[model samples]
Target: MSDTLEILLTNDDGIDSVGIRAIHDALVEHANANVTVVAPASDQSACGRSISHGGEIGLVDHELGYAVEGTPADCVVAGLAELGPDPDLVVAGCNRGANLGEYVLGRSGTISAAVEAAFFDVPAIATSMYVPVDETPLREIDLSTDDFREARRVTTYLAEYALDAGVFDHAAYLNVNVPTPGKRPAPIEITRPSKRYEMDAEATDGSVTLHDRVWESMDPETIPDPDGTDRRAVAEGRISISPLTAPHSTNHHETLTELAETYHDRVATADD
Candidate 1:
């Protein structure tokens, strides 16, 4: 929250990715923050928290930043543990695609980067842009840094205020998604990830094909997202910021507790 902030910037996309470049530039120009960019050498999209561990990780100078030949999570670990200039905030993404819904929390490399930072006890922000899809696959959309204006804007704004405002006091990190660029800037919304699941698989010939039926729900008219969900906010042309915690929660289950208590008795009876 100082006039000059130390920030670690990263993404699921490769170091050459336009999204990360925009983020780096935005932070430097707008937030006046000292930023270090460490990201994958090649696209590591959807590669959750998987790390390279003992495997050798190569780092090379990239036009945008330092490129790590590893997963997004690996980049974070390296940046925090070995990389110089520890950060006050870790910012990930300006991702080409939206990372929405509770289901995506585990699969999205964008969110995974933030989760890794939180484990290191650093407050982080994960920002992504919603790329609309119709009959064609979302990947077909050719995105450039130019496509990430809104995402960069929102990210810079949050970088400036979120820390001083104590946003991280309640949340470990934030999962932010902005609707595609428009004539005017979209409003921000506080939201939670939607609990929506729709995956279908079929065997075609000798191969099994998996289809994500959730894309069908992206249509604003058909989406089942409720008022305060991230999905709903993005669908309605608003920026969605889902405050999230990194650690998994443990809740007491009566059935599991009973099973544990009875297990010894059952084992003794069986032995007898």
Candidate 2:
């Protein structure tokens, strides 16, 4: 990678999202980075690494960049394989909502975009901002650029440093969560995903409501994760960076190995 980074940017929250725009602006102004954005034309949150598989996908040209009528992962695939130049790095998000914890790793479209890039042997980073749920009626939350300043700064800093410092040599990608900007810039913490999970389901009148209790435990005082976990750090109003690998890992199991080796014998016995 050259000193001037070639970055392919994407996000779950469409190409027009404020968060993605903030990140694009920051990278251009602060790092002098060359960026090409190809993102979902519409919100694809929680879509994970889903692609359009043989279906037709449309790409629309926009002021910020290309808008892909597909999932976040599809944007990465299109950006890397068809739309733009080969990128030195893939940066996804500055997502509207935080994506933390181990359980969300495979389900979050923001992180899944980064994971998709990693599979192509490219270094990637995924970022998000935590938005607290309000009791008020659901309305379009208008976020000013200030709301994304911290995430932009962190994304710029990481994009420059991680490429220069060879941090990708150790990990496939990074999952970053930043708290809402406060009176001062928050501290950065290197963390792991929290293992805690909370879910509740209820059925009434033949319909069902599923609730994710993880949000309820997001308060710093109530979070169950240890201090060094992403959930804990985010709850404590810190920027959390979790280095992660894209592949699912497996360990050798003696019993499984034995079962495989004796498969023929078992089959013969069954026949008898």
Candidate 3:
């Protein structure tokens, strides 16, 4: 790694979003990084790792970087394979909302971008801020670059030093979630993704409405996540950094082995 970093910066939010711009400026101005922004042209949040397979992915030159007509994952694939220089690191987001649970790991476009980079043997970081639900609806809440001050501070620190610190030696990528800044700055904490799952569906008039009940319980007092979990850390006004691997890990099972061994015998017996 050189003193100056070559970074591929992207996000699930559109390139015009404040969060992406905040992070992009932070890395370049603070981390002394040369950043190439290859982000979605439109909001692609929660699109996960879905790519435009066998389809054309359009790219437009923007003042900041390239605006990709695809998902967050596609931005990374394009950045690493074609659009940008071979980056030392790939960063996805300063996303609008928090992605803090195990269930969200496979569903968040912000995190999926980082996961895509890991497959290319590059270190990556996925960042998001936990927005508190208030009387103002989430969609109506307007956030500015000021809202991302803490996120930018933390992300820039890591980007500047984490590589030389060997933070990525064991972890394929990092999932970082920052709490909305308060009167005092939030402290950073290492954490694991929470396992709590609370999804419900209501069916009426031949339509089903899916609800993720977890958001309602994110209050510090009501959150059921343990102290060391990402959701809990964020709810308690701390930055949560969860080191994670990209690949799906499988455990060896004797029962599955035995089942495989009996497969031909069972088929023959059924035929007989």
Candidate 4:
């Protein structure tokens, strides 16, 4: 158990979402830590950091959390700045679905919540479970403390030790996805985010449709990936942990130096 660390937990799912509850309970039980849950009042999946600057924000009180009327990013900004004193860590998700691959990095509200935390210079982790479709929403999955037993186990282990172990030395955040614990519990491994994507769009009558079909298009029997990629390992019943850094890095590049010099030369010509 962690010794009384302060943790701020939110999720892409609403503040009242079952996934968050499982996470909060797990942290409390496993880490024996002080935790505060401040999350959006409604489902905010895929809604990056968008928040209305002057909109009215309502609070829906819960036994374990406060549901704010805003996006996942709004919840984190609110959680870190005004909810409780700055948390030592920020944890997002235990999401009902997986967030993996390169294209998913930008589109996932679950991971976005953790990205928001990174900008604040806090260590953060995002977690999710991959559910196959041809199914109803996850609330119909008969959720319970038992449902997230392994997700919580992996999350608890990382949350307890990742920081002191410097596991995040090269990454801004960790993205973890646990396989459904059924016949067997899988091995855990460190892996990289897979860079694969496929989106199928269709237009019918006067409406267009967008579908994410990479999971469907995959041939698990053939399994093209060379191992150690998040997608392949998880497909093979392994819990995958990927450490990622915030995008949009700025550094000195010599090619850009010439471009800057050209811009200065243009300014001189204009002045002349």
How many pairs collide in each candidate, listed in order?
0, 0, 0, 0
Model 4 lDDT per residue over 91-209, tens place:
99889878878888888888999999999989899999877655565456666667777788888888898888887777889999887766556789888988777788999999999
Model 1 clash pairs? Answer: none
Model 3 residue-pair collision total:
0
TM-score of 2: 0.96
Alpha carbon lDDT of each predicted model: 0.90, 0.90, 0.93, 0.83
Clashing pairs in 2: none
What C-alpha lDDT, on a 0 to 100 scale, does residue 135 get in candidate 2?
Answer: 71
Q: Give the top-scoring candidate (lDDT).
A: 3
- In terms of TM-score, the best-performing candidate is 3
Model 4: lDDT of residue 170: 78
Candidate 1 lDDT over 121-205, as tens digits, reads 9999999998878877766777878789999899999999999899999999999999988988899999999998887899988
Question: Relative to the unseen true structure, what is the C-alpha lDDT of residue 187 in candidate 2, on a scale of 0 to 100?
Answer: 99
All candidates' TM-scores?
Answer: 0.96, 0.96, 0.97, 0.89
What C-alpha RMSD separates each model from the true structure? 1.4, 1.4, 1.0, 2.8
Error at 113, model 1, angstroms: 0.4
